[model samples]
Target: MKVSSCLFNSLLLSAGVGLLAPLAQAGEASEEVKPAPLELDTAFVTATGGATDLKDAPASVSVITREEIERQPVYDLNTLLRRVPGVTGGFGPVGEQSKIKLRGLDDKYTLILVDGKRVGSSADLSYRRDLARQDLNWISPNMIERIEIVRGPMSSLYGSDAMGGVINIITRKVSRTWTGSASTHITVPKDSDRGQTTQYSANASGPLTESLGLRLGANVTRRAADEVEARRDAQGDFMYDDGAGGSKNQSVNALLDWQINEEQSLSFEAVHGVERSWASKKTFGDWGDTIGVSFGPSRLTRDSYILSHTGDWSFGTTKLDAYLNKYRNDLDMGKANSEEKIVEGSLNLPFELLVDQRLTLGGQWKREELTNTNTLGTVPVDYQGTPVSGSTLKGDYSAAFIEDELFLLDNLSLTLGNRFDHSDKYGNHNSPRAYVVYHPHPDWTVRGGVSKGFRAPSLKEGSAGAATESGGRGCGSLRPLGYLTGSCWMAGNPNLMPETSTNKEIGLSFDHDGWEAGLTYFHTDFTDKIEYGPLGQYQGRWWTMLENVDKARTRGWEGTARVPLGDSVTWRTNATYMLESRNLSTGEDLISSPKLSAFSALDWQINDRLSTELSAQHVGKQRGLGNDFVQSYTTYDLTANLALTKWLTLNGGVQNLMDKDLRDGSTNFYVPGRAFFAGATTYF
Candidate 1:
């Protein structure tokens, strides 16, 4: 069938199926509805790589609920991340390539996990780093149940990449006996330079029996071609511009959970997705396809599996709990790819030593193996029109850790944790953390903490190959340096050292009545920071190299507030400000980090059937690695949701309402402009 025809059919089928399933089940006796009690505490998992009440956990944590995700009308992961206190978006020019920053650290310093397992490649490079973080574009907003963000060193619990923080993406799970919904959205650009996007998604979850549950979801997204006018320089040459580009994506996910016995449970999940797009860079009187020039037509696919078991037993007054998990990941990136496997287990014991005091102990172990392959160029073809000169890379890592939490008094608590890891690439290392929490009153809480963390080198850091003149054909004259250079070049390093960091933080949280607020201050020091040097004059051509640099520091403050104006109205605002400086022989501000960032939203519930929200976001100016300053930018968004009936809802929003013309200094690219979107969700 024709692609367009298939899409239409799929939409209709999904909508019909989703609406009908719930209605059919509605005929049965309704189950008891128990509204969860409202609480001011945050929810998180990264601090321990397991679900832990944020109020009791030893680290600084934050949670963005599903309601918050819809309040700001955010569609991509970057949009959601901007709301995070100390985190900042990265230097990539395109949406798919954007990175995340934590405590002023790059993507490699922060770890991202889905369902508590790492799945992608997170090689920290200077030009374009590969992060294991899932691409938000492939995930529909409706698929997320909630997001848990823990800030600060957590390597003791989650291992490498948890040097600065962790982001755990929890997808929608089956919660009710039977549920299903479908939604459709369209984004309309405000100007000719911007393009339009249309998306459709369907999700369903229910119990096959009292002991088994299942969930299935799918989404398809499309973007119409659009062009951005070039910005010209004094000599009539285009300084920067993104030409016409378009993209299409499709994805599907399935999950199953089973209760094998009273003491054990098992769950399985799978996801598949594909994306295609054409991008370009444009200059006055010069236009070229970005593919192969900037990068090429890229394709990526991933497969993952997880198995876990949990059990509990009591030994007198001491209680023991243990869990074991096995995971696997397979990634394909056209000319380059990787496969990884890991097995991990943990044990925990919590006991009361005295009436008002308690002790907690924990230990964990993990084993991992990775295999990778990469070709030299866009076309791996050789002298005889056949692919040649590829490399195979492999490695392993292992770690163990222990932690303790002690309640010194009814209002005070202390926590201590340590971890040791040994890797074939980096030998051995250890990390330690300590924290104290004091509650002077029922409405106020104070916390202080310090920690050390480290990140090991990735496969690309050591085995990446270079286009040397002696080893390859047509590589002799390829030079990537200076203005008249031959293009771009990349080379690897084998002697690179692991990056290490030390962090200190203090914070206060208070809530009473219908108002809540929090503030935190943090400082971080980094050593042996990986530096990807810019293209330089090498053999008369521009060449790039990866190297480890000296010390760097970042200090920042974050503040948040939420107040209820009335029974049906609320106001929420959050702001993050940071001072980042790096002294790599040359003193300068870090690249890609905004000195000030903020997000605020006001929501109103017009009765139970209608609601509206307004939000604003700001990003401060930043300096590039080259010391060039980029202008700051701000944007406003508006959204409205209406419950037309018990089973039908409509949502509409407009983003970048100011039509701001924003450019990033690091990547020298302009972001998307003002756009409007509307969607309808129906449930039987």
Candidate 2:
């Protein structure tokens, strides 16, 4: 979790109950259908970021159902996202440092959410990640209902990290019928030296009363490390891989809902999660010195609390949500430590503005604070070079927005939205979005939109000493997400401005006779791109400061398809190809970014008690995080499920079937060859 000291100023935690839009009617599935297949024609709430039909939204959206989650050979959120077209995850410089890039955009550009509110820190520059991201590892897969993704600018709807897109992890809901399930899995690498991973979880949901319901879930996971023989150093001595630094995480969550009335509802939720990892863990010893040098043992803890109320009465529906989140990241090196806290609230109202049109109005207020200290850290000094102590920093943000969806015809509609945001340090700015969706036929549709997005300067960038903060291998450039690794630091730029970009997209989809396909093309122009260093003679290196000195353009194509093979087999695939990701300011190729990525799966059902699936993925080369000459890799996976009885089922899979050597030089992330796992699920 610790990336850099900037993580204290840049990283943040966000929590909210989320603004849930009202639904027109209840949806019921036929019990006779038994176990139905994945639905591609279903509705989703993340495209427009509200309760809207997927076919009616004017943005490119994809959904991963609970069923799919149960079937995929993945453990974390970033890995799950790679299966989505136009998205890819960095292999890593550090195991936990891996991030998602959408349409060749950096992780900082994408936003992640839990329920309806944001997850992880809003900003984390580095220094052991005082405010590290609320990683998916915190949530139990058994507690999820579904995951929705929007692959395009959505700043007008959700502000900030929406420039690239949004990934919303929706938790399971309270069920009307008493229901619960328990599941566990174990994974073993082809090479025993690589160690193993074991995970388990249980969840339950049902009605406590005619108008009251509750849901509870919990999970525990542990990963063993490895002691592989790495390339030798110049001395000809074999180097040791840091894979020995293993990790453990656990979480407990609860949700209580009260249907106060047919038109009103109240809910309260709580989530507690903690994680521990060590860089010095050794394979031969209980706790080895695998870390070698620098960074040391580390741990991060996070907690979230939320309360929400929604009502649908009179002429419109209204929603109010409040949340508080706290995080602590600690590194034994220099006794580095970072603690962050965030409190937020928002109100939303959706009302009919015309006979066939609806308007949504909303406002939000939030505050972020961070405190961090390291014995080896530098404080801003006086003009006389006297070091001053500054271990705490904070900032406030406020915003108001409006969205109008107007129907021009029964089959044609336009969505227009605008938002204005004010930050104590960066001042105020406005963002706008426009989209038109037209359905020429029930089976065919077209959609397109233009939008603007921006990212506010972090408190570290606006308040740190101009020259006192320094360290890291990437000190020479404004690194993208995960910029700092070693001792890298930068001189603060108080006058720094927010980063900005404009995006345009066009897309079409077709569905008929169990055939579904979609294609989208996008182009984005970025300005005021933020990074460190504008080459200078100062200290014989680039001046490290947050400056608006970069510009660039990117274009790409994304496509997805699903076809039913007979009545028992199905095939699905998604792919993305980026044509360019250039740095106009430096006229150089960009850093780690997705170029060509594709995912395909085939599912077969053998009778009513047995089923199997095969999947493959191919990822093209990408620039190293800060180095030159990145690499490309491909992997395959196989999985199977068998119903032992009405309430019990067996599941298993083999990941990295080809055992392809997967690793990114810039990021410490690596694939330890092929692995196999098996587990069982039981219902009650």
What's the lDDT for all of these models? 0.62, 0.68
Put down candidate 1 lDDT per residue, 1-684, tens digits, no spaces. 012444444444433342333345545554422223122234565675334566666778878787766543344567777677777773223532256777767666777776566655423211234323334444666777777888887877776788879888777766546777787776666655555678788887888998898988888876655555455644555544344356566778787878777666677777776665555433334464332122222344545555555555462122122222221222244234445566666655666776333333443444433333333332243222333355545567777777666778888878778888887778888888888988899788899899998888776665445322222212223334324423444555667888888989999988899799999998888888875555444444344555786678888898889999989889988888885545544477776677898888888865555577888888788764344566677888777766556677666767787877644223344566776666677774
TM-scores for all predictions: 0.82, 0.85
* lDDT per residue (tens digit) for residues 365-427 in model 2: 877765555422254452234465765677788888888878878899998889898887778
Q: Name the best candidate (by TM-score).
A: 2
Candidate with maximal lDDT: 2
Looking at model 1, residue 384 earns an lDDT score of 26
How does residue 636 of candidate 1 score in lDDT?
Answer: 86
Q: Model 1: clashing residue pairs?
A: 292-295, 382-386, 480-542, 481-541, 481-542
